[model samples]
Target: MPGKHVRFSRNTHFQSPPTPALSFSSISPASSYAPLTPPVIPNNYLPGPSPYTIGYAPIPKAPTIRVHPVLEYSSHQNVDFDILNHPSSITKNRRLLSSLVLSEPATSTPLRSMVITCPHLPWIITVYPQSGSHITVYDVFYEIYRSLHKSITSSDFASLPSDSARRASTRAYEQRYSRHRSSRHRDEEKRSGMLRIDFLMGMTRFAGLSPTGRGPDVWQLNIR
Candidate 1:
């Protein structure tokens, strides 16, 4: 009976079993995964037109130019005669001087004296008693026309030794003939036939006149 009492003692507490270690080797190679989905865009949304598009851009317009009408004259003689009766007193004096220089005998002592006494003609004239009696007004005019042609079209400034002299001569020539070249001057000259002769002395200054009336010549008035 004692032996049976000693063997009857028992435990009341319960114990859990040990857990297995986790590793990649434990995972299945043929395991199924869900496929990735893309984000959704609105159907109404659209991109703007690119600046690089050629036909889509507007073309620029060309600039408009305004041109003035050129004035026309009847004849060259009408134009030439107009300078004599110009409204401008200065122009009249200059034209008168030119006329006198061209028309009058270059060797006439009295004419030379008159030109000398007149404050306008600065060039000194040594009248050699030789008369331009044979040279008529028509001849002088013809010579003038020839000189004008040479002055206008001829590029012969080779006679002038210095550049400064050439330039000065060129400028003087331009100033003298500028009126003849202009359409307005031509029109005015043509209309000035009825105007009175009011020759104002010392009203204008003539440039490029040689002091001795010898050299540095542009147009030769070969009336002598």
Candidate 2:
């Protein structure tokens, strides 16, 4: 047993290798570096033309509509939109509304006066150029309107007074007449005794005596 071959154990004769220490000064920041990027526009964003021109613009050279009410309800004047003096007739977004009357000439004579029985109701009058073709309701009304326009724009044009003015004038005239009548009646009362002297005398002659003793005469004839 003493002569057995001696075997050297590796662990008993070996030493542990030394480990390197970590140092904070030798650390590098290569992993922390980042690139900057521009902001992203949303997908739903929409662009448009100038928003200033989206509003309404005034129409050029449009005739000023002057609505003069001659009836009780001028707003009710309704006519087909097709029956106007359209020089360069183009359909427009805006329309004119009014209650007016255009005068029509009588069948036998040119009477351009609007003959209305009741001026209190609403009505409209439109003017149209003369047409060589057959007459329609529109034609008639248009012709009437032309006549009225001509008459209105002429030097001899005179509109009738309104109801209020007419009523006031009539009342004044009646009052004056009443005052005249009352004065005339008072004068008649004053002259009544003088006018009856002659008639009484004539009657007294037959009845035997007159209270004033005067003869009957034309100036003193008893009218009452």
Candidate 3:
């Protein structure tokens, strides 16, 4: 058996298999893959001021503070000599007297008005001020005691209406005077004199004297 011969044309060519177009149903879901994100950068990477920001912020101001003036003794420019001298005037103006005494400087001199002759006694008690010398509660007290003692010991004090009244007055005066002689006394005697002065001035109890505590000599007057 003879086979038939097959011949191909010069223009005849063989082609590769055509690629198929991808369909939506055939594609995988985007959730299956990880999401894309920007890279992380450190704070020190920029090494300069931010472009969005301006100059440095203003500094806050400090709060204002008010300081009060300290209370101190004043010079006796407005003191009335007549009122300061008279016992009756002192009795009438106990509060005013207290204020005046409290404001007096410790180194202040005894005014001439402080000198007085005892009405009930024959003695004249005087406080003489010396240059550059300071006075203390003790000195004032001593003068007051002398004046009070002279009065209490006089015939006039003994001639009070009732004997009981006279005895009470004597006992009171002695009790006050005896405190100075006590061993435990500090400035107690002076305090007693202050009380006596207040009583004589007709005040039930006036403000008391206080030590400045800065020194043994420094004293402050307290007014209530």
Model 3 misplacement above 4 A: 1-113, 116-125, 130-142, 149-154, 173-224
C-alpha lDDT of candidate 3 relative to the true structure? 0.32
Estimate every model's Cα lDDT from 0 to 1: 0.27, 0.24, 0.32
lDDT of 1 by residue, 54-128 (tens): 553444432221110010112222113322222122232335323333333322111212111122222222222
The candidate 2 region of ten consecutive residues with least summed lDDT is 215-224
- Between candidates 1 and 3, which one is better according to lDDT? 3
User: How would you encode candidate 2's per-residue C-alpha lDDT over 48-103 as one tens digit per residue?
Assistant: 76657655454443222111121112233222232112211212234432211222
Ranked by lDDT, top first: 3, 1, 2
RMSD of 1: 55.1
Q: What is the C-alpha local distance difference test score of candidate 2?
A: 0.24
Which candidate ranks first by lDDT, i.e. highest? 3
Task: Work out candidate 2's RMSD over C-alphas.
Answer: 57.8
TM-score of each prediction: 0.22, 0.17, 0.25
Model 2 CA deviation exceeding 4 Å by range: 1-133, 151-159, 162-224
Q: Which has the greatest TM-score?
A: 3
